[model samples]
Target: MSEAVISLSNAFIYQKENLILSDVNFSINKGEFVYLIGKTGSGKSSLLKTLYADLWLEKGHGKVAGFELENIKYKEIPFLRRKIGIIFQDFQLLPDRNVLQNLRFFMEAMGWDDKMKIDDRIMEVLELVGLPDVLKKHPHQLSGGEQQRIAIARALLNHPEILLADEPTGNLDPEKSIEILKLFFKINEVSDTAVLMATHELGLIERFPRRTLYCDGGIINDLTGNS
Candidate 1:
């Protein structure tokens, strides 16, 4: 049996007091690559947030990276996050810090204190993202795609079990977007890390199809059925 890294059943997702999605059901097995698609207001982000425990799962059962979403405690949020990587459309790199510093900061925050190990891990992830030469560059010094690559490298720092990306290619051009998409697939294959990316790029989906979950009408439908 495939090990599920993320599973949601009868899940209700809420943004503050507003309910975004209801009756959500799905399971993403280890090393699986899945897409979440829908219109702008169709709760794709809400669903991702719920999986990562950013938004509370109020009325259903959800499990991610071995952490239960329902009734998760405040102290456990950081630990939950440690087991999952999150990528955002906007590259969230600190402007004042260079690439190496930014990565080191994240590793330290995640409780990695060994200097040599931190440096080695940073180089490993940067190489994995194909940006090993940009260790000394700042975010503004890099192009949109480079910045996004660095963000991806940062997300891989702790060897997360799953990667949660929210429109990671939204800010890039078509060529760069496809490049990023390919990189994600490479990571999925090489690292055996599951990925649940929320995106509206139907063209990319057509180009490289995978199991997809569609969010609409306040509910999630697993289009592939196999999930």
Candidate 2:
């Protein structure tokens, strides 16, 4: 069996006085493609935030990408982030920097210093995402789907064990959405990178069925009803 890449046990999250997530429990094994579905305010983003250490764990236990989340030191967050890739709904690419520069920034931040190796890695991931020709294009120049692909390439800079995508296809039209989804499918099939995506698009879920975790009524239900 594949190892558990992310594990949550009775996890709870709070935003000041109100509880965002309550007693949430789910486990994502290595190379598994899982969908995280919930209505607005269902704590989908908060849950992802908690996993990536964006929000603090007020109660319960959670482990992500081999790092224990609860009571984790602030300084360790960067290290934890290194093991995971996070994709946001809004492509967070720099407005001025070209594709290669944006990717290089992340590599540099992650302590990659060799210029030759950095260029090679950037090219490798861009190719992996089918954007080999986009290295010179600015974010504004690329189409919506192309920009999202660049974001995915940026996320792959570290070859992370897991990819946490929050509404990755939210901004695209249906056709483009499918294109991005297929890209994700290809990535998972080829690299065995576990993908935990939070999305409202049920069509994609129906089209490419996989393990699902549904969030509703302040509770998370693993569709398989298993831990």
Indicate the worst ten consecutive residues by lDDT in candidate 2. Answer: 13-22
Error of 2 at 1 (Å): 2.8
Looking at candidate 2, what is the lDDT of residue 56? 88
All models: lDDT?
0.93, 0.91
Model 2 scores a C-alpha lDDT of 0.91
Over the stretch 10-34, how does candidate 2's per-residue lDDT look in tens digits? 8888777689778888899889899
Candidate 2 clashes between residue pairs 3 or more apart in a chain or in different chains: none
Off by over 4 Å in 1: none
Q: What shift in Å separates residue 188 of candidate 1 from its native position after superposition?
A: 0.4
Top-scoring candidate (TM-score): 1
Backbone clash tally for model 2? 0
TM-score of 1: 0.98
Instruction: Please tell me which predicted candidate would have the highest lDDT against the true structure.
Output: 1
Question: In model 1, how large is the Cα lDDT of residue 138?
Answer: 91
**Residue-wise C-alpha lDDT for candidate 1, range 107-165, written one tens digit per residue:** 99999999999999998998999988998999999999999999999999999999999
How far in Å is the alpha carbon of 179 misplaced in model 2? 0.9
